[model samples]
Target: MERAVRWDRLREEMAREGVELLALVPGANLFYLTGLHFHRMERPIVALLPREGEPALILPAFEVEKAQRAPIPWRLFPYTDAEGPASAFHAAAAALGGRGHTIAVETLGMRVLEWSLLAEAFESPTPLPAEPLLARLRMVKGPEEIAAIRRAIAAAEAALQQWLPEVRPGMTEREATRRLIQACFAAGADALAFEPIVVAGPNAALPHATPSERPMGPGEMMIVDFGVIMDGYVSDLTRTFVLGEPDPETARIYEVVREANAAGRAAVRPGIPAEAVDRAARAVIEAAGYGPYFPHRTGHGLGLEIHEPPYLVQGDRTLLTPGMVFTVEPGIYLPGRGGVRIEDVVVVTETGGESLTTFPRELRSL
Candidate 1:
C-alpha cells in the first residue's frame, strides 16, 4: 500500500465533500490508513485524518511501539491505562485545530464510547457520513491486494480438494465442518473467513444453516459453503453435492443454478452496472420458474472485509471497473427439499471478468 498516495486521495475527497477532518475507530479504515490494528476496548483508539498535514492517532500507552512502526508518519498521543484516554483525545483534537471543525465519521464502525469522547473533544462537532468516501477509496483493489486474495482462494481450494473426498454418507455435518477447518489450517490459511457451512439433506434448503449433528444420508443433497483467510484477504465459495443418486427435481434445480451462476459470471465486465450481473443471474432462475426460491443478492465485494462495496444486487448501480473483485453465487432452494448453490470469486478486468476460484462447479456425488 502507498501510504502517502492513499492519504492524499483521502484528503482530496474530504475537501470535495466539505469534511474538515475524518475520525476513524479501530477497524478496516484505521488499518488501511496506518498499518496498525488495535482491539476495541473501554480505552478508545481513534485515528484522525486532517484535511492537511500528517494524520494523528490516540491509543493506549502500551501500544506505542506498534504505532511507531506504522507505514506513514503520524502524531501519536498515547495515554496510560490508569488515566484513561481523555487527555489523549484532547491533545489530538488540539493538534487538528479543534473546536467547530466539520468532522466525518464512519457510521458503522464508530462506537458510542469513541463518539462521546470525540463529541467532548470538539467545541461544535458536525459529523458527516464517511462511508461513501471510504467505500470509494476501497472499492478498487491494488495488485498486492489482488495477489493476497488469490492466495486465499488457493488455500481454500486446496483445503476443499483434500477434505471433500473424505466426506462419507454416515459422517455428521458438524464432523464434516471440523474436518474442513483442519484442512484449511493445514493448507496454510491464517484463519477462516467465516464458519464453514455443512448442511445435509433438507437442512441444505436453508441458505445460512448451521452445521448440526445430523448424519449425512444417501439420496440427499449436501451443501458446503466456506472460505479461508490469507494475509487478511478472504475467499468465499460454495459447492453442492449429493450422497447418492439425486432425484430428477434435484438434478434439474442444480443445472438451473449452475447456469445462473455462469450467467452471473459472464455478465461481469468493465463499465457495466453491478445490477446487470444480478439481473443476468436472476433471469436464468426466473426463466426456469424458480425465481422466488433463489433469494439473496448475486454477490458482494470482498477484500479486507468479507462483505463490502459495489454489491451485486437489484438497486446497486455502481459501474464495474478493472481491479474490482466480488463473487457470483446463484442458488435455488425448495421448501421441503434441498438447494443448489454455485459460487465463484470474480475479478473485473479491462476486457471482462476472471474467476479466482477454480473448484469444479459440476455437481459431484460423494
Candidate 2:
C-alpha cells in the first residue's frame, strides 16, 4: 500500500508536469517504487509508469518472478535472449498509449540503449527530465527510511569501533581498509556505501584519496572515510586521526575544521535555506584563514543514494524541512601536509537537527 501511494503521487506529479508517462531503468527509483533491484546488464529492464492505468515492466524472462513480487500491480512484458527486448518494449509502449506521448525519464540514470529502445517503441516520443519530480519525492524521508539509515549508521560506527583498536603504526592503508570492511560486514552491514578511503600523511590532502600501500606512521595524520549500507539506506562518515602527537599547525587546523563541522550541524533546522548551513560552516574556516583549502560543499543528502538533493552548498536555496537527512562535513587541507575532515549524518526535526553518527569527533591518537 505504501508503494502504491508513492506511485500514485508520482503519477499526479507527472500529470501536473505535462508528462503522460515516466520511465525508469534499473536504479534507485525503480527500487523505490517496486522494492526490487535489477543489475545493469546487456539486456535492459525498464519500467513505464503512466499517469493513469496500470504500470508496465519490460524485462528479461528470468526476472518475471521478481516483477510479480512487486508491491503494486504492474503489467509484465517479459522477453527472452533470442527474442530480444523489442517486443516487450513495444508491448509496454502500446499499453501506455503509444506514439507521441510525453515521457519523463531520469536523465542522469537512463542509458542510451534504453533511450534508443524507447525511441524505437514510441513514435516521436517527447522526452522530459524527471529529476526535479523525483528529487522532491525523495528529499523528505519517511519513518521507515529514517530507521534504516539509523541502522546503517550504527553498523558503521560499530565497525569502526571494532577496527580502531587493531590499528598499528606499521599497518598499510589497504590493510586497515580491509579490516574495516570485514568489521562492517560482521556488524551486520548489508554492503558498503563505497570503497573505504584511508589516506595518511601527504595523501590525506586529497579529498577523495584512495587507500594506498603507504604505511601509517607516527607523528602524522590519517583520514579514514567510510560508510555502511543497511536495508538499502546508507551512512557516510569521515574522521581524521593522529598516530601520536601532532604538530602545532596540524592540531590548529583540526580544531578549525571541527568547529566548522559543528557550526554546519547547528545551522540545520526546519525552514532555513540549505545554503545557510554551508555559509555557517564556511565562515568558520574562512575566519581561521583556510577558506580556499576548504573546497567542496559542506555535505549532501543521504539515503538510497549516497548523494542526493538538499545539498549544503553556496547558492542552493532549498529549504531544510523535517525528515530530511544529510551530512555535515567540513575540512581543511594544506598541500604537502595533511587534512582534517569531521563528518556526521544528521536528520532535520521540527525543533532542530539530530545527528545519527555519534562516533567521537575529538581527535583520536592510535
Which structure among the candidates has the greatest lDDT?
2
Model 1, 272-313: lDDT tens per residue?
999999999999999999999988999999998888988999
**lDDT (C-alpha) at residue 309 in model 2:** 90
Model 2 over residues 1-366: C-alpha lDDT tens digits? Answer: 778688778877887799888999998888898898999999999999888888899999999998887666889999999999998899888888889988899999899999999999997699999998998888999999999999999999999999999987889999999999999999999999999998888889999999899998887899999998899999999999998889999999999999999999998899999999999999999999999999899999989999999899988899999999999999998887888899999999999999989999999889
Give me the runs in candidate 2 sitting further than 4 Å from their true place: none
Which stretches of candidate 1 lie above 4 Å from their native place? none
After TM-score superposition, the amount by which residue 93's alpha carbon in candidate 2 deviates from its true location, in angstroms, is: 1.1
Tell me which residue pairs clash in candidate 1.
Answer: none
- What overall lDDT, based on C-alpha atoms, would model 2 receive against the true structure? 0.92
Report residue 302 deviation for candidate 2 (angstroms). 0.8
If candidate 1 were superposed on the true structure by all CA atoms, what would the RMSD be? Answer: 1.3
